[model samples]
Target: MSFFTEIQTERLRLRKLKHTDWEAISYLRSDPDVNKFVKRASADTQEKALAFIEKIRQATETNSSLYWVITKQGQNQMIGSICLWNFSQDRKKAEVGYDLHPLTQGKGIMNEALKAIINFGFNTLNLNRIEAYTQNNNTASINLLKRNNFKLVIGKQDADNLENAVYELKQP
Candidate 1:
Protein backbone atom coordinates (compact mmCIF):
# COMPACT_ATOMS: atom_id res chain seq x y z
CA MET A 1 0.00 0.00 0.00
CA SER A 2 2.95 2.33 0.46
CA PHE A 3 4.28 1.83 -3.04
CA PHE A 4 2.79 1.62 -6.50
CA THR A 5 1.80 -1.99 -7.04
CA GLU A 6 1.33 -3.72 -10.33
CA ILE A 7 -1.90 -5.66 -10.87
CA GLN A 8 -2.18 -8.54 -13.27
CA THR A 9 -5.17 -10.40 -14.71
CA GLU A 10 -5.59 -13.11 -17.27
CA ARG A 11 -4.95 -10.74 -20.17
CA LEU A 12 -3.97 -7.38 -18.68
CA ARG A 13 -1.34 -5.76 -16.54
CA LEU A 14 -1.68 -2.57 -14.54
CA ARG A 15 1.59 -1.00 -13.45
CA LYS A 16 2.95 2.33 -12.31
CA LEU A 17 3.22 5.15 -14.75
CA LYS A 18 6.50 5.44 -16.65
CA HIS A 19 8.24 8.30 -18.42
CA THR A 20 7.99 6.42 -21.69
CA ASP A 21 4.22 6.15 -21.34
CA TRP A 22 3.88 9.84 -22.15
CA GLU A 23 2.59 9.21 -25.64
CA ALA A 24 -0.30 7.02 -24.54
CA ILE A 25 -1.03 9.26 -21.58
CA SER A 26 -1.15 12.24 -23.85
CA TYR A 27 -3.63 10.54 -26.12
CA LEU A 28 -5.77 9.18 -23.30
CA ARG A 29 -6.00 12.50 -21.48
CA SER A 30 -6.65 14.67 -24.50
CA ASP A 31 -8.62 12.61 -26.96
CA PRO A 32 -12.07 14.11 -27.54
CA ASP A 33 -13.77 10.73 -27.41
CA VAL A 34 -12.16 9.85 -24.09
CA ASN A 35 -12.62 13.28 -22.55
CA LYS A 36 -16.14 13.77 -23.81
CA PHE A 37 -17.42 12.80 -20.38
CA VAL A 38 -14.45 13.73 -18.21
CA LYS A 39 -13.82 17.33 -17.29
CA ARG A 40 -10.15 17.87 -16.51
CA ALA A 41 -7.11 19.77 -17.68
CA SER A 42 -5.65 18.42 -20.88
CA ALA A 43 -2.25 16.70 -21.05
CA ASP A 44 -2.25 16.62 -24.82
CA THR A 45 1.45 17.26 -25.12
CA GLN A 46 4.32 14.98 -24.11
CA GLU A 47 5.59 17.65 -21.71
CA LYS A 48 2.23 17.87 -20.02
CA ALA A 49 1.89 14.11 -19.87
CA LEU A 50 5.29 13.85 -18.22
CA ALA A 51 4.30 16.47 -15.69
CA PHE A 52 1.12 14.55 -14.87
CA ILE A 53 3.10 11.35 -14.47
CA GLU A 54 5.47 13.12 -12.09
CA LYS A 55 2.56 14.37 -10.03
CA ILE A 56 1.17 10.85 -9.79
CA ARG A 57 4.62 9.60 -8.79
CA GLN A 58 4.80 12.12 -5.99
CA ALA A 59 1.32 11.17 -4.79
CA THR A 60 2.23 7.49 -4.66
CA GLU A 61 5.42 8.29 -2.74
CA THR A 62 3.38 10.15 -0.16
CA ASN A 63 0.75 7.41 0.03
CA SER A 64 -1.82 9.82 -1.34
CA SER A 65 -2.76 7.72 -4.36
CA LEU A 66 -1.85 4.79 -6.61
CA TYR A 67 -1.97 5.21 -10.38
CA TRP A 68 -1.56 2.43 -12.90
CA VAL A 69 -0.94 2.32 -16.61
CA ILE A 70 -2.94 -0.43 -18.31
CA THR A 71 -1.35 -2.64 -20.91
CA LYS A 72 -1.97 -5.95 -22.58
CA GLN A 73 -0.51 -9.00 -20.81
CA GLY A 74 2.63 -9.19 -22.95
CA GLN A 75 2.61 -5.68 -24.37
CA ASN A 76 4.70 -2.75 -23.22
CA GLN A 77 2.52 0.01 -24.68
CA MET A 78 -0.11 1.65 -22.53
CA ILE A 79 -3.72 1.47 -23.68
CA GLY A 80 -5.38 3.01 -20.66
CA SER A 81 -4.97 4.07 -17.03
CA ILE A 82 -6.65 3.64 -13.65
CA CYS A 83 -6.17 4.98 -10.14
CA LEU A 84 -7.47 5.17 -6.61
CA TRP A 85 -7.35 8.73 -5.33
CA ASN A 86 -9.26 11.47 -3.48
CA PHE A 87 -9.20 9.43 -0.32
CA SER A 88 -11.24 10.49 2.68
CA GLN A 89 -9.48 11.69 5.81
CA ASP A 90 -9.86 8.32 7.57
CA ARG A 91 -8.57 6.50 4.44
CA LYS A 92 -11.50 4.10 4.48
CA LYS A 93 -12.81 5.59 1.26
CA ALA A 94 -11.22 6.52 -2.04
CA GLU A 95 -12.32 7.55 -5.50
CA VAL A 96 -11.63 5.38 -8.51
CA GLY A 97 -10.90 6.78 -11.94
CA TYR A 98 -10.15 5.12 -15.27
CA ASP A 99 -9.91 5.61 -19.02
CA LEU A 100 -9.46 3.28 -21.98
CA HIS A 101 -8.22 4.02 -25.45
CA PRO A 102 -11.15 4.15 -27.85
CA LEU A 103 -9.79 1.27 -29.79
CA THR A 104 -9.86 -0.88 -26.68
CA GLN A 105 -13.35 0.00 -25.56
CA GLY A 106 -16.16 -2.63 -25.32
CA LYS A 107 -13.57 -5.40 -25.01
CA GLY A 108 -14.02 -6.02 -21.25
CA ILE A 109 -10.45 -4.86 -20.62
CA MET A 110 -11.41 -2.14 -18.19
CA ASN A 111 -13.75 -4.50 -16.40
CA GLU A 112 -10.90 -6.95 -15.83
CA ALA A 113 -8.64 -4.19 -14.55
CA LEU A 114 -11.40 -2.88 -12.29
CA LYS A 115 -12.06 -6.26 -10.68
CA ALA A 116 -8.41 -6.48 -9.67
CA ILE A 117 -8.38 -2.90 -8.42
CA ILE A 118 -11.49 -3.49 -6.32
CA ASN A 119 -9.88 -6.53 -4.73
CA PHE A 120 -6.79 -4.48 -3.97
CA GLY A 121 -8.80 -1.66 -2.49
CA PHE A 122 -10.89 -3.80 -0.19
CA ASN A 123 -8.23 -6.39 0.70
CA THR A 124 -4.78 -4.84 0.42
CA LEU A 125 -5.75 -1.27 1.25
CA ASN A 126 -8.49 -2.42 3.62
CA LEU A 127 -10.76 0.30 2.39
CA ASN A 128 -14.44 0.25 3.24
CA ARG A 129 -15.65 2.01 0.13
CA ILE A 130 -14.55 2.75 -3.39
CA GLU A 131 -16.34 5.51 -5.30
CA ALA A 132 -16.65 6.42 -8.94
CA TYR A 133 -17.94 9.57 -10.62
CA THR A 134 -19.04 9.61 -14.19
CA GLN A 135 -21.02 11.89 -16.42
CA ASN A 136 -24.68 11.04 -16.12
CA ASN A 137 -24.80 10.39 -19.83
CA ASN A 138 -21.97 7.88 -19.64
CA THR A 139 -23.96 4.65 -19.80
CA ALA A 140 -20.85 2.58 -20.44
CA SER A 141 -19.27 3.60 -17.18
CA ILE A 142 -22.49 3.31 -15.27
CA ASN A 143 -22.94 -0.19 -16.58
CA LEU A 144 -19.39 -1.11 -15.76
CA LEU A 145 -19.85 -0.03 -12.18
CA LYS A 146 -23.06 -1.99 -11.94
CA ARG A 147 -21.38 -5.09 -13.30
CA ASN A 148 -18.80 -4.78 -10.52
CA ASN A 149 -21.50 -4.52 -7.83
CA PHE A 150 -21.13 -0.78 -7.33
CA LYS A 151 -24.39 0.89 -6.38
CA LEU A 152 -25.63 4.32 -7.20
CA VAL A 153 -24.93 6.59 -4.25
CA ILE A 154 -28.38 8.02 -3.71
CA GLY A 155 -28.59 11.77 -3.14
CA LYS A 156 -24.83 12.20 -3.25
CA GLN A 157 -23.45 14.95 -5.44
CA ASP A 158 -20.01 15.41 -6.96
CA ALA A 159 -18.96 18.84 -5.69
CA ASP A 160 -16.12 18.94 -8.17
CA ASN A 161 -18.21 18.02 -11.18
CA LEU A 162 -21.95 18.41 -11.03
CA GLU A 163 -22.41 16.45 -14.22
CA ASN A 164 -20.96 13.37 -12.58
CA ALA A 165 -23.12 10.59 -11.23
CA VAL A 166 -21.80 9.14 -8.01
CA TYR A 167 -21.53 5.39 -7.38
CA GLU A 168 -19.87 3.27 -4.73
CA LEU A 169 -18.90 -0.32 -3.95
CA LYS A 170 -18.71 -1.11 -0.29
CA GLN A 171 -16.23 -3.70 0.90
CA PRO A 172 -17.90 -7.07 1.06
Candidate 2:
Protein backbone atom coordinates (compact mmCIF):
# COMPACT_ATOMS: atom_id res chain seq x y z
CA MET A 1 0.00 0.00 0.00
CA SER A 2 1.65 3.17 -1.25
CA PHE A 3 0.18 6.64 -1.11
CA PHE A 4 2.18 8.52 -3.70
CA THR A 5 4.08 6.73 -6.42
CA GLU A 6 7.38 8.58 -6.10
CA ILE A 7 9.09 11.86 -5.43
CA GLN A 8 11.89 12.91 -7.73
CA THR A 9 14.85 15.13 -7.00
CA GLU A 10 17.64 16.37 -9.18
CA ARG A 11 19.92 13.46 -8.37
CA LEU A 12 17.61 10.96 -6.71
CA ARG A 13 14.21 9.32 -6.87
CA LEU A 14 12.34 8.49 -3.70
CA ARG A 15 10.10 5.51 -4.41
CA LYS A 16 7.77 3.46 -2.28
CA LEU A 17 9.56 0.59 -0.58
CA LYS A 18 9.16 -2.84 -2.10
CA HIS A 19 9.76 -6.36 -0.82
CA THR A 20 12.81 -6.59 -3.06
CA ASP A 21 14.32 -3.74 -1.09
CA TRP A 22 14.78 -6.01 1.92
CA GLU A 23 18.48 -6.62 1.35
CA ALA A 24 19.42 -2.96 1.01
CA ILE A 25 17.03 -2.05 3.78
CA SER A 26 18.58 -4.63 6.04
CA TYR A 27 22.04 -3.32 5.37
CA LEU A 28 21.09 0.32 5.86
CA ARG A 29 19.10 -0.27 9.02
CA SER A 30 21.54 -2.80 10.43
CA ASP A 31 25.03 -1.72 9.43
CA PRO A 32 26.92 -0.42 12.44
CA ASP A 33 28.13 2.72 10.74
CA VAL A 34 24.68 3.48 9.34
CA ASN A 35 22.70 2.85 12.49
CA LYS A 36 25.27 4.39 14.81
CA PHE A 37 23.13 7.48 15.35
CA VAL A 38 19.79 5.72 14.89
CA LYS A 39 18.06 4.71 18.09
CA ARG A 40 16.07 1.66 17.01
CA ALA A 41 17.38 -1.86 17.27
CA SER A 42 19.14 -3.17 14.17
CA ALA A 43 17.25 -4.97 11.38
CA ASP A 44 20.23 -7.22 10.73
CA THR A 45 18.34 -10.31 9.63
CA GLN A 46 16.07 -10.84 6.64
CA GLU A 47 13.08 -11.60 8.86
CA LYS A 48 13.60 -8.46 10.88
CA ALA A 49 13.99 -6.38 7.73
CA LEU A 50 10.87 -7.87 6.14
CA ALA A 51 8.87 -7.23 9.28
CA PHE A 52 10.04 -3.64 9.35
CA ILE A 53 9.03 -3.16 5.75
CA GLU A 54 5.60 -4.63 6.44
CA LYS A 55 5.14 -2.22 9.31
CA ILE A 56 6.02 0.75 7.13
CA ARG A 57 3.83 -0.48 4.29
CA GLN A 58 0.87 -0.89 6.56
CA ALA A 59 1.36 2.57 7.96
CA THR A 60 1.46 4.01 4.47
CA GLU A 61 -1.68 2.19 3.43
CA THR A 62 -3.47 3.53 6.44
CA ASN A 63 -2.38 7.03 5.51
CA SER A 64 -0.57 7.39 8.77
CA SER A 65 2.92 7.45 7.33
CA LEU A 66 4.95 7.61 4.14
CA TYR A 67 8.38 6.08 3.66
CA TRP A 68 10.52 6.13 0.56
CA VAL A 69 13.59 4.26 -0.51
CA ILE A 70 16.16 6.65 -1.92
CA THR A 71 17.98 5.81 -5.13
CA LYS A 72 20.12 7.62 -7.64
CA GLN A 73 18.52 8.81 -10.89
CA GLY A 74 20.34 6.50 -13.28
CA GLN A 75 20.93 3.83 -10.65
CA ASN A 76 18.22 1.69 -9.12
CA GLN A 77 20.36 0.84 -6.11
CA MET A 78 18.81 2.03 -2.88
CA ILE A 79 21.23 4.32 -1.12
CA GLY A 80 18.99 5.29 1.79
CA SER A 81 15.48 5.99 3.07
CA ILE A 82 13.37 8.93 4.26
CA CYS A 83 9.99 9.15 5.89
CA LEU A 84 7.31 11.41 7.35
CA TRP A 85 5.67 9.76 10.28
CA ASN A 86 4.24 10.22 13.80
CA PHE A 87 1.44 12.40 12.63
CA SER A 88 -0.54 14.57 14.96
CA GLN A 89 -4.26 14.04 15.45
CA ASP A 90 -5.22 16.79 13.07
CA ARG A 91 -2.79 15.48 10.46
CA LYS A 92 -1.14 18.87 10.26
CA LYS A 93 2.16 17.85 11.82
CA ALA A 94 4.59 15.01 11.27
CA GLU A 95 8.14 13.97 12.09
CA VAL A 96 10.76 13.49 9.43
CA GLY A 97 13.49 10.87 9.58
CA TYR A 98 16.06 9.78 7.05
CA ASP A 99 19.28 7.89 6.41
CA LEU A 100 21.84 7.67 3.62
CA HIS A 101 24.44 5.07 2.76
CA PRO A 102 27.87 5.95 4.11
CA LEU A 103 29.27 5.98 0.60
CA THR A 104 26.72 8.62 -0.38
CA GLN A 105 27.24 10.81 2.65
CA GLY A 106 28.74 14.31 2.30
CA LYS A 107 27.41 14.41 -1.26
CA GLY A 108 24.26 16.43 -0.35
CA ILE A 109 21.98 13.60 -1.48
CA MET A 110 20.03 13.55 1.75
CA ASN A 111 19.92 17.32 1.71
CA GLU A 112 18.24 17.29 -1.66
CA ALA A 113 15.81 14.61 -0.60
CA LEU A 114 14.96 16.57 2.53
CA LYS A 115 14.17 19.67 0.54
CA ALA A 116 11.86 17.79 -1.80
CA ILE A 117 9.99 16.01 1.00
CA ILE A 118 9.70 19.16 3.05
CA ASN A 119 8.22 20.87 0.04
CA PHE A 120 5.77 18.04 -0.51
CA GLY A 121 4.74 18.25 3.13
CA PHE A 122 4.13 21.95 2.98
CA ASN A 123 2.65 22.39 -0.46
CA THR A 124 1.10 19.06 -1.34
CA LEU A 125 0.11 17.76 2.05
CA ASN A 126 -0.68 21.19 3.44
CA LEU A 127 0.99 20.36 6.69
CA ASN A 128 1.26 23.15 9.20
CA ARG A 129 4.52 21.95 10.72
CA ILE A 130 7.14 19.31 10.21
CA GLU A 131 9.44 18.18 12.98
CA ALA A 132 12.63 16.17 13.35
CA TYR A 133 14.58 14.66 16.21
CA THR A 134 18.27 13.99 15.93
CA GLN A 135 20.77 12.86 18.48
CA ASN A 136 22.53 15.88 19.93
CA ASN A 137 25.85 14.47 18.82
CA ASN A 138 24.69 13.94 15.25
CA THR A 139 26.22 17.14 13.94
CA ALA A 140 25.66 16.38 10.28
CA SER A 141 21.93 15.96 10.71
CA ILE A 142 21.73 18.99 12.97
CA ASN A 143 23.58 21.07 10.42
CA LEU A 144 21.38 19.87 7.60
CA LEU A 145 18.24 20.77 9.50
CA LYS A 146 19.64 24.15 10.35
CA ARG A 147 20.58 24.82 6.74
CA ASN A 148 17.00 24.09 5.83
CA ASN A 149 15.76 26.58 8.43
CA PHE A 150 14.48 23.97 10.85
CA LYS A 151 15.04 25.66 14.18
CA LEU A 152 15.83 23.89 17.41
CA VAL A 153 13.00 24.18 19.91
CA ILE A 154 14.60 24.94 23.22
CA GLY A 155 13.22 22.94 26.15
CA LYS A 156 10.80 21.05 23.94
CA GLN A 157 11.10 17.28 24.12
CA ASP A 158 9.67 14.39 22.17
CA ALA A 159 7.40 11.99 24.03
CA ASP A 160 9.43 9.10 22.62
CA ASN A 161 12.18 9.88 25.14
CA LEU A 162 15.01 9.00 22.78
CA GLU A 163 17.16 11.85 24.11
CA ASN A 164 17.24 13.72 20.84
CA ALA A 165 17.17 17.42 20.05
CA VAL A 166 13.87 18.52 18.51
CA TYR A 167 13.74 20.77 15.50
CA GLU A 168 10.69 22.19 13.73
CA LEU A 169 9.92 23.72 10.36
CA LYS A 170 6.69 25.65 10.26
CA GLN A 171 4.74 26.19 7.07
CA PRO A 172 5.61 29.43 5.36
Candidate 3:
Protein backbone atom coordinates (compact mmCIF):
# COMPACT_ATOMS: atom_id res chain seq x y z
CA MET A 1 0.00 0.00 0.00
CA SER A 2 1.19 3.50 -0.73
CA PHE A 3 1.94 5.99 2.04
CA PHE A 4 -0.69 8.35 0.67
CA THR A 5 -4.05 7.26 -0.59
CA GLU A 6 -7.28 9.23 -0.57
CA ILE A 7 -10.25 7.47 0.98
CA GLN A 8 -13.50 9.14 0.10
CA THR A 9 -16.61 8.77 2.19
CA GLU A 10 -19.95 10.57 1.82
CA ARG A 11 -18.69 13.64 3.64
CA LEU A 12 -15.05 13.04 4.53
CA ARG A 13 -11.74 12.01 3.09
CA LEU A 14 -9.11 9.91 4.82
CA ARG A 15 -5.78 10.76 3.26
CA LYS A 16 -2.15 10.29 4.22
CA LEU A 17 -0.45 12.80 6.47
CA LYS A 18 1.53 15.49 4.71
CA HIS A 19 4.44 17.73 5.68
CA THR A 20 2.20 20.72 5.00
CA ASP A 21 -0.17 19.40 7.66
CA TRP A 22 2.26 20.37 10.39
CA GLU A 23 0.47 23.56 11.30
CA ALA A 24 -2.93 21.91 11.74
CA ILE A 25 -1.49 18.83 13.44
CA SER A 26 0.55 20.99 15.72
CA TYR A 27 -2.51 22.90 16.84
CA LEU A 28 -4.56 19.77 17.42
CA ARG A 29 -1.78 17.96 19.30
CA SER A 30 -1.16 20.99 21.42
CA ASP A 31 -4.65 20.89 22.84
CA PRO A 32 -4.51 19.31 26.28
CA ASP A 33 -7.94 17.77 25.78
CA VAL A 34 -6.99 16.36 22.37
CA ASN A 35 -3.68 14.97 23.62
CA LYS A 36 -5.22 13.58 26.79
CA PHE A 37 -5.47 10.01 25.54
CA VAL A 38 -2.72 9.95 22.93
CA LYS A 39 0.68 8.40 23.55
CA ARG A 40 3.75 9.95 22.05
CA ALA A 41 7.45 10.40 22.77
CA SER A 42 6.92 14.06 23.47
CA ALA A 43 3.66 15.99 23.41
CA ASP A 44 5.04 19.41 24.19
CA THR A 45 6.96 20.46 21.11
CA GLN A 46 6.62 20.92 17.36
CA GLU A 47 9.54 18.58 16.94
CA LYS A 48 7.55 15.82 18.57
CA ALA A 49 4.74 16.35 16.10
CA LEU A 50 7.19 16.35 13.21
CA ALA A 51 8.76 13.17 14.53
CA PHE A 52 5.35 11.52 14.68
CA ILE A 53 4.56 12.51 11.10
CA GLU A 54 7.95 11.16 10.07
CA LYS A 55 7.37 7.91 11.92
CA ILE A 56 3.97 7.52 10.26
CA ARG A 57 5.60 8.20 6.91
CA GLN A 58 8.25 5.58 7.58
CA ALA A 59 5.68 3.04 8.69
CA THR A 60 3.64 3.56 5.53
CA GLU A 61 6.79 3.51 3.41
CA THR A 62 7.68 0.11 4.84
CA ASN A 63 4.11 -1.16 4.38
CA SER A 64 4.04 -1.99 8.07
CA SER A 65 1.08 0.26 8.97
CA LEU A 66 -1.39 2.81 7.67
CA TYR A 67 -2.35 6.23 9.04
CA TRP A 68 -4.65 8.81 7.55
CA VAL A 69 -5.48 12.42 8.16
CA ILE A 70 -9.26 12.90 8.31
CA THR A 71 -10.39 15.85 6.27
CA LYS A 72 -13.57 17.08 4.66
CA GLN A 73 -13.99 16.74 0.91
CA GLY A 74 -13.32 19.95 -1.06
CA GLN A 75 -11.67 21.41 2.02
CA ASN A 76 -8.09 21.13 3.24
CA GLN A 77 -8.79 21.33 6.95
CA MET A 78 -7.60 18.37 9.01
CA ILE A 79 -10.05 17.34 11.71
CA GLY A 80 -8.46 14.16 13.01
CA SER A 81 -6.39 11.03 12.34
CA ILE A 82 -7.23 7.34 11.98
CA CYS A 83 -4.70 4.56 11.90
CA LEU A 84 -4.18 0.81 11.82
CA TRP A 85 -1.19 -0.22 13.86
CA ASN A 86 0.62 -3.27 15.29
CA PHE A 87 -0.08 -5.36 12.19
CA SER A 88 0.73 -9.04 12.55
CA GLN A 89 3.31 -10.64 10.31
CA ASP A 90 0.78 -13.27 9.25
CA ARG A 91 -1.66 -10.39 8.58
CA LYS A 92 -4.25 -11.80 10.92
CA LYS A 93 -4.71 -8.95 13.36
CA ALA A 94 -4.17 -5.26 13.95
CA GLU A 95 -5.14 -2.42 16.28
CA VAL A 96 -7.00 0.73 15.40
CA GLY A 97 -6.51 4.17 16.92
CA TYR A 98 -8.08 7.52 16.24
CA ASP A 99 -8.52 11.06 17.57
CA LEU A 100 -10.63 14.02 16.50
CA HIS A 101 -10.11 17.67 17.11
CA PRO A 102 -11.91 19.01 20.15
CA LEU A 103 -13.76 21.49 18.02
CA THR A 104 -14.97 18.72 15.76
CA GLN A 105 -16.35 16.56 18.54
CA GLY A 106 -20.09 15.63 18.65
CA LYS A 107 -20.35 15.80 14.86
CA GLY A 108 -20.31 12.08 13.98
CA ILE A 109 -17.15 12.60 11.91
CA MET A 110 -15.19 10.08 13.91
CA ASN A 111 -17.86 7.43 13.63
CA GLU A 112 -17.79 7.73 9.86
CA ALA A 113 -14.02 7.63 9.80
CA LEU A 114 -13.96 4.57 12.06
CA LYS A 115 -16.34 2.68 9.81
CA ALA A 116 -14.22 3.41 6.74
CA ILE A 117 -10.99 2.34 8.43
CA ILE A 118 -12.54 -0.82 9.83
CA ASN A 119 -13.69 -1.79 6.36
CA PHE A 120 -10.23 -1.10 5.03
CA GLY A 121 -8.69 -3.24 7.75
CA PHE A 122 -10.91 -6.21 7.14
CA ASN A 123 -11.58 -6.04 3.43
CA THR A 124 -8.56 -4.22 2.03
CA LEU A 125 -5.88 -5.46 4.39
CA ASN A 126 -7.52 -8.86 4.84
CA LEU A 127 -7.15 -8.87 8.59
CA ASN A 128 -9.14 -11.34 10.66
CA ARG A 129 -9.35 -9.27 13.83
CA ILE A 130 -9.14 -5.65 14.81
CA GLU A 131 -8.90 -4.33 18.36
CA ALA A 132 -8.83 -1.07 20.23
CA TYR A 133 -8.02 0.13 23.72
CA THR A 134 -9.12 3.29 25.41
CA GLN A 135 -8.88 4.78 28.84
CA ASN A 136 -11.85 3.92 30.99
CA ASN A 137 -12.64 7.59 31.35
CA ASN A 138 -12.87 8.05 27.60
CA THR A 139 -16.50 7.16 27.15
CA ALA A 140 -16.71 8.73 23.73
CA SER A 141 -14.10 6.41 22.33
CA ILE A 142 -15.57 3.36 24.00
CA ASN A 143 -19.00 4.20 22.69
CA LEU A 144 -17.64 4.80 19.21
CA LEU A 145 -16.03 1.37 19.20
CA LYS A 146 -19.19 -0.24 20.52
CA ARG A 147 -21.29 1.44 17.88
CA ASN A 148 -18.93 0.07 15.26
CA ASN A 149 -19.57 -3.52 16.50
CA PHE A 150 -16.57 -3.93 18.74
CA LYS A 151 -17.44 -6.05 21.72
CA LEU A 152 -16.27 -5.41 25.24
CA VAL A 153 -14.50 -8.65 25.88
CA ILE A 154 -12.29 -7.43 28.77
CA GLY A 155 -13.07 -5.32 31.79
CA LYS A 156 -11.28 -2.69 33.85
CA GLN A 157 -9.47 -5.04 36.23
CA ASP A 158 -8.12 -6.98 33.30
CA ALA A 159 -6.32 -3.93 31.99
CA ASP A 160 -2.58 -3.60 32.42
CA ASN A 161 -2.93 -0.41 34.45
CA LEU A 162 -6.50 -0.81 35.65
CA GLU A 163 -7.35 2.30 33.68
CA ASN A 164 -8.20 1.00 30.24
CA ALA A 165 -10.79 -1.21 28.56
CA VAL A 166 -9.94 -3.42 25.62
CA TYR A 167 -12.44 -3.94 22.84
CA GLU A 168 -12.23 -6.28 19.88
CA LEU A 169 -14.02 -6.85 16.57
CA LYS A 170 -13.55 -10.08 14.69
CA GLN A 171 -14.17 -10.35 11.00
CA PRO A 172 -17.17 -12.43 10.05
The candidate that achieves the highest lDDT relative to the unseen native structure: 1
Candidate 1 C-alpha lDDT tens digits along 1-172: 4756888899999988889999898999899999999999899888999999999889999989899889999999999999999999999999999999999999999999999999999998899999999999999999999999999998999998899989999998
Ten contiguous residues with the weakest lDDT in model 2: 1-10
Tell how far residue 124 is off in model 2, in angstroms.
Answer: 0.8
lDDT of 1: 0.93
User: What lDDT is obtained when candidate 3 is compared to the true structure?
Assistant: 0.82
Ranked candidates (TM-score, high to low)? 1, 2, 3
Q: Write the per-residue lDDT of candidate 3 for residues 15-38, one digit (tens) a residue.
A: 989887877777777777886875
Give the count of colliding residue pairs in each prediction.
0, 0, 0
Q: What lDDT score is found at residue 12 in candidate 3?
A: 96
The predicted structure with the larger TM-score, 1 or 2, is 1
Local distance difference test values of all predictions, in order: 0.93, 0.91, 0.82
Report how far residue 65 has shifted in candidate 2, in Å.
0.8
Models sorted by lDDT, best on top: 1, 2, 3
Candidate 1 Cα deviation (angstroms), residue 99: 0.1
**Which has the better lDDT: candidate 1, or candidate 2?**
1
